[model samples]
Each structure stands twice: as structure tokens, then as C-alpha cells.
Target: MVSTLSRRTLLGGAVALGATGLLAACGRGGSPTSAQPGSGAWTFTDDTGATVTLDARPTRIAGLNDAIASLWNYGVTPVASFGFTGLADDVNFRGKDLTRVTEVGTTYGEIDIEALVAQQPELIVTHAYPKDSSGTLDPQKPLYGFADLKQQQTVAGIAPIVTIAMSGSAADVVERTVEFAQSIGVSQEALEQPRRDYDAARERLRAATASGLSVMAVAAYPGEGVYIAKAPDDPALLSYTELGLNYPDPGGSDYYWQQVSWENILDHRTDVVLYSLRAMSGADMQQQPTFAQLPAAEAGQVFPWEFSAMDYVAQARTINNLAEHLEGSRKVT
Candidate 1:
């Protein structure tokens, strides 16, 4: 019930998250253990290099919003969730029934630890970023959504935590999340239709990129400015680029975002704008005094970039919607 802005602190600043051990994170989901359920012991080595061992497969699970939404595609729902998971009209939720899931942390950094503990989850899964907007963690925080390392550790103490990379390629992020889902007794039978949908959607996206639309991704803070993504550094944007999307120059030095005032918003010109829903609605961004003068904004070329949910169903939806936008856009810049 407590929906909030994006906890996508991953793209909030100039911090460069070089790369992560995504393959190592995927090197899990022991078939015997995961497939057989409680018949044998279960163990998973997360991106942080920690091996969480359990006497039996963990049945009750808790996770960050995006992680849980991703798991839902494989029919694995969490008992508790944190972060801004429902920002995009729950489209990333893939029609999964989340009524029973407890909202642990509605925004970022602030977790209702007591509510999470009440769920008695056996395992907690979330993404890992090098640091957050908060400078408290110094060089690295690793855990993605929690306020800092201490909060993440406090939650970890309640239930063993498993992490996947939040700063790698979309495929790597999706794979790690899927592996986590598979490790927790997801039905391979349930994956068939999604596989077909994903393949179709990806091809559609590749084709739509041929529309020659120059798109720029950004998250705007009303009073401050806008943080535009450096395409190669962002997981989803990189994936789109790899699929042949022509994104305008994504300016930034700290690795991901280049903070620019409204006066300089035109520096990153594009035919279409992939704005994050975390900041505000597209309508609100359109209402900005100076933002209204931008060519794409005036041309009604803005689209919601609902940060990643990493699930096949959700990802396919994002791909298809973007493809539709690309196919319909006119180069206003």
C-alpha cells in the first residue's frame, strides 16, 4: 500500500559500478537440491561470495520489489518485499497475486524489519550495487536497496541473503535472478510460454531500433536537475544498444549519470525520451516550464522507463512497449 519513488539508487548518481561476478552468481541452482525440494540440503553462493546453506530448501522467501517481481514470472512469490516494486502500475509484476506479500520497505533504505521478521522467511534475495546515494558506505555498499551496509546486515541476520548483480548486462541480471528463482523450486514447465514471449519481444525490439529513433534515458529531480544515463554503463540501456538502438550521447563522468540543470537539458538531444517513472509521471515532467520547450517533450516523445524488474514476462512487456514507442516516434531533435 505504501508505493514510493524508485529505489533505483543504482542509477541515481555518478558512481561507476565497473562489473560484477554475474557468472559466479549464475553458478547455482543445484538440480538435486532445488528440484527435489526438502528431500536434500540446499545451498547457493550469491554475488557477494557468501554461501547460504540450509537444512532444506527455503519455502518462505523475502526479496526486494524488483527481485520479487522477477521471481513472480517463474511463479515464485515472496512472503515479504521492499523497495518501489509497484511504480509502473504493477506492469512488471506480471499479473502475479501480491496481496499476501508483506511490503517490508516501501521506499529505499528504510525497512520495516519487524514486519519482515514476522513473515519468518528462510531466505532473502535482492540485487547488489557498489554504493547508494548515501555516502556512508564509502567505496562500496554492495547490497542494492537497503539504506547502508548496516541495514542490509541487520536484514541478513534475520534471514540469509542471496544477491545478484544490479550493475551488469540485462542478460546477466536476468539470468542471476532466474537462477535464484529456479533454485527455489520454480517449475520449468511454467517457463515455456515466457521463453516464447521473450524471444518474440526481443526480436520486435531489435526491429524497432531500426526506426532510427534517437532516445535518451533520464531521471529528473524537480528542483535539482536531470541525471542522464551513460548507455554502456546501464544494464537495460546497454541491452537496447546491443540490440541496435541509437541512443543519443549519454553524458556523465562518474560512470552512469551526468547531472545537468534544466538550462542544459537540450545538451542530450533525442527524438524520444525514456524517462524514469521513479521521479514523477511523464505528465508532470512535461509540465516543467523549461522541459516543455524541449523538442521531444513538445513532440510528446516521452516514455516511462520503469526501472528493471528482470523477469521474462515483465521484461518482454517493457521491450514491447518501447518498441511500440520507437516504431511510432518522429525525430524531433
Candidate 2:
């Protein structure tokens, strides 16, 4: 699975994550992390079961871009995203306005400590996976993007760290993020509209999935062959299954994907596919041997696997998008 991980992709340690919006607030004495001289109004218990307390709710925060996408939907913006380098070109940031956010980590394995220090974040929020979904790397990395445990510890020195777990239902993960945002000062009023839209989207997906399209998710590599997503390891797939999606369990011992040779992909049955564009573009995958002959490809039922930015509105759009696509889809498997 490590063979498929590229620095440019969210598959770096994690991916089952996301959402968007901006909120302006400042932390204690304007420090990267501190109490509000004495008031201490901020405290939250994260998904990882860690409680974070601060003087005033952290106004200046630094975090992973994936979470930023979700918070952006609620207008609870961060001061910076550790992995951002400011490319506003639309790959669907889901309203994570990069223009107002600082880029603290310029590379995949490194965070710019100096840049993070400059942001004066009272708290640091990021995604954490106790086990590497890919199963090839160290499973102990407490946070995504940072190099290792020591690196995570190093960053924590600048500000208190809170982690959002990336495992489970995408909806559950997103709502957990919503709860976090609310704790940090985002109003329930700001979240209700998105919540309504998300609920509507789910109904649309439920209706679409009734058409019975056999679906699969995959990542194709040039020489390493194709990787079929193992549904049990994907929060997006898990959640969608509840929405009535017919995604099969592409079984494997690995944590997330089952690797098959180019020719071997023919053994799998699918009517529609959610391909990882980061692994290879749709045009390229269409040209691959054996893969091209699949019913999903021939019928143009391929879609991008984009659970990376999972705010409620963003996912609502994604759910509605697939439902819309099903309007043109047929049973080709």
C-alpha cells in the first residue's frame, strides 16, 4: 500500500477525512498556546478522548487542510493548515479559503516550525490514525502530515494538540468535527443549514442506490498495478453503504486496499467505479490494460474518490452528485 502513497495525495498516513468555512477569533494573550491570562473558557474532548483546555477559545489555530475543509463549512476557520502551499485552483477545496490561511507545512513530511510559530496558534488541530490505513508504514504516528511521533511532539511544544480520528462513518467523523467547531465558538445556527442540506443529500443517495449499481473503488498505478479499496477500511465507503450504496467488500488482509496486477483487475465485477484521480487520472486509467474492458469504464461510470475533504456540505454535494450521475447510469456489470 505504501507503493501507492504519493506526497501530493491525502493518502499520506490518512485520507478518510474533510469540510469548509472561516471564523475569526484569537487565543490567550495572542500566544500560540496559552490561557487567557486567567479566564480559561475553552475546553473540548476530542474524538481520541483527549480533553484540551485553554484560557479563551482558541481564535488562532493551526491544523491539517483536511479538517480545514470541514471547519470552513461552519465558518470556523483556522490561522493555517500545515500542508497548505496556497494553490487556489479548484480541485474542490469545499470553501477552505486558502487566501486567508497561512501555509505552515510546505512539504509532505515536514512542517515549517517557524511558520507555525508565526501564526501564534493557541491550539493545533489535526487528523490522527492509530493505525496506518495502508498498513505498510509505522502505525504509531499520532498525527497526519508530520514525520513521526517525535515530530508530533515537537509541534505540540508550540501549542496544545487535539486530534480528530479519521476512522468510522464519514458522517460521524464530520459531526465530530462539527462538535469541535462548536466548542471553539462556531454557532449551532451556522451548522443547521448545512445539516439540513446533508440530510437531503442522503435521501437522494438512498433513492439512487435503489437502482442497484454494483460499485467499486480503486487506485491505479503505472507499474505497480491497481489497488482495489477494501470497504471495511474506508469511512466513506462504510458511510455510503448505510446510504444504500452497493459497494462490494474487496477483501484483503491489508488495512485498506487489495493490490491486483493490471490484468488481474478483470476478475472483479463492477457497474460503476470511484477511481482515485490522485493515483492516475481518469483518462489514463481508461487506457490501462484489462481495466478498460470493465463495464464501469466502458459505460463512463467512473467517478473520483474524494472523501478527503468531508465537511457535511461537501459530502452532501458528493452524495447528490453520485445520485445525479445514476440518472445516466445503467446496469453494465
Candidate 3:
């Protein structure tokens, strides 16, 4: 188990993250597929618009990107997770310890093809829409075209493919997640509660903010710096905006999360700070050198949110969870 850092250290790291200018390189690799039958079928899609059909609903799934954190909420833990080993290492998403999960790649759009093939995942999940519609494939790594991911499966004779979006917006991720769970026969009842909870939470937050509570959603990582979510105005950042929260300048629209410094956070003096963390314990931030100095921390204004919600449907459930917790001003233990 990794130990949590002191609050000062955590806050200092968050400050550093702002100065260093870090943004998560996350995006789904494919477009939404036409729904079809596949129970326990190994399904997959490549980056090139080709589909690879498999025989079973993948049990040993392999997630190629860090944004797949939503998969866990749906109970779709992969045998291997690219990027960070587990949730603990993830600065944005917390409550997951992927130490048991395989590390497939570092950063979005990059994958360990050889290692992926070795895992022999029954199903391979990746992003497709970002590439198909946006033409925003990572410039650095050779992003796998839909066809490429499929071809890889053909060679290994593994399961088929499934493609979902990673970057459209929070809602896009949520809908895709519901669709995926529905595809696999996850109970509608199981899924519905989270949505309802999210709705209730949203309504509650909006009501609470009527009294005027300033809120900002932030993604803070140690060396990477703090990046605020785009404002809720655009289709993407709409969720948080509905809560009557204010985003630092450059509201939404930045595509990748926007970097913010402690000074910037203080300047805004937001009444609430929604932060993302992966497997962070209360003790972790307490030990950090600079965490307590931050206005949010000093004022007891920070709340921990997981970064795994980049996948939409799962995000909705997570949003609901966050709403339930924060609506009552409940702090994460």
C-alpha cells in the first residue's frame, strides 16, 4: 500500500503542477459502434475504422488508456491497464489500486502492442471517435487506427473489439458507458440509481449555489500542475457549470484540462475546490509540505474527485457519488 503524503506536500505538488504545465493526454480511440449482440464476446475495434469481432464478452479486458477509469464503476476491471500501474499512481482518479492491473502504456495514444498482445485480453477497449471525427490523433505516438487494433487481434486470434469515445465530453463518456453495460447485460436497475443520484445531486448543488457558492473543478497532479476542467458552458463542461460553479478564465474549450497555479486558485478564492486523485488517503495530503498552505486546503475547501470518470457513463455514476458526498458537505474519508 502506498502511503499518503502530508497536506503541505500534496498542495506544494499541486502548485508545482500548475507551474510545470501538465495536461492529461487522454482520448477515446474510436467512434461509437452500432449496437449488436455480444455476450461474453471478445470484441474490438481498431483506430482505422475496422472492426474485429470476437467470441465472448471479454472477461480479461485490456484498457489501453488512462481515461478508462469509468470501466471499473461498471465492474469491468481489466487484466491490464496502461499508463499508471493502478489507481494509486493516478493523480486525477482515486479509489483504484491498479497494482493488480497490468501497465500497458504511458500517456494517451501510446500502447505497448507487444505487451497488449501478450495479455491476450478476451476483449480490447479503446477510443475511436477522437481520431475518426477530430483528426486529433496524438502527434507523438503512432496512434492505433481502428483497423490497426483489429489487425492486431486477427494476428493473435484473440477476441473481437469494442470502441468507445474518450474525449467528447463528460456526458459522451457516460452514455457510452451505459451503452456498453447494456450491451453486456448489466442490470438497468444497477445503472439507473447512479443516474438518479446524479440528477438529485445536480439539483441539490444548484439549489445550494443559489445562495452563491463559488465552485471550481480542478485536476491536480504532482509534477504536472493543476488543470481546471473546461467550464460547464460548452457541451463538454456543462455538468459542473449547471452547479453554478465558476471556472477560471479560459472556461472549458481547452480540449485537454487547463493548468492552474496555487496563486491563480487563491486569486479566484473559490469557495469549493473539486480535485481529482487516485487512491489518496487523508494522511497522504497531511504529510505534503505545501498542501496546507493553499487557500482551499487552509480554508477546508478541497474535495477529492477521481479522474477515472473521463469515460462518460461511469462518470455520471461518479458524479452522482460526488454529488451525494458533497451535497451534504460530506468530506471523503
Predicted structure with the largest lDDT when compared to the true one = 1
Whole-model alpha-carbon lDDT for candidate 1: 0.70
List the candidate 2 regions with Cα displacement exceeding 4 Å. 1-40, 84-97, 130-139
Candidate 2 local lDDT, 65-94, one digit each (tens): 767767776776678776533325334463
Worst 10 residues of 3 by lDDT: 14-23
lDDT of 2: 0.68
For model 1, the superposed segments whose C-alpha errors exceed 4 Å read 1-7, 10-39, 85-91, 131-142
In the range 224-286, model 3's lDDT, one tens digit per residue, is 545565553223345556566444454434443455553454444455566645423324543
lDDT of 1 by residue, 164-238 (tens): 656556866776677777788787788878978987999999999887889888888777677777776667887
Q: Ten residues in a row with the worst lDDT in model 2?
A: 19-28
Q: Candidates' TM-scores?
A: 0.84, 0.85, 0.58
lDDT of model 3, residue 46: 36
Ranking by lDDT: 1, 2, 3
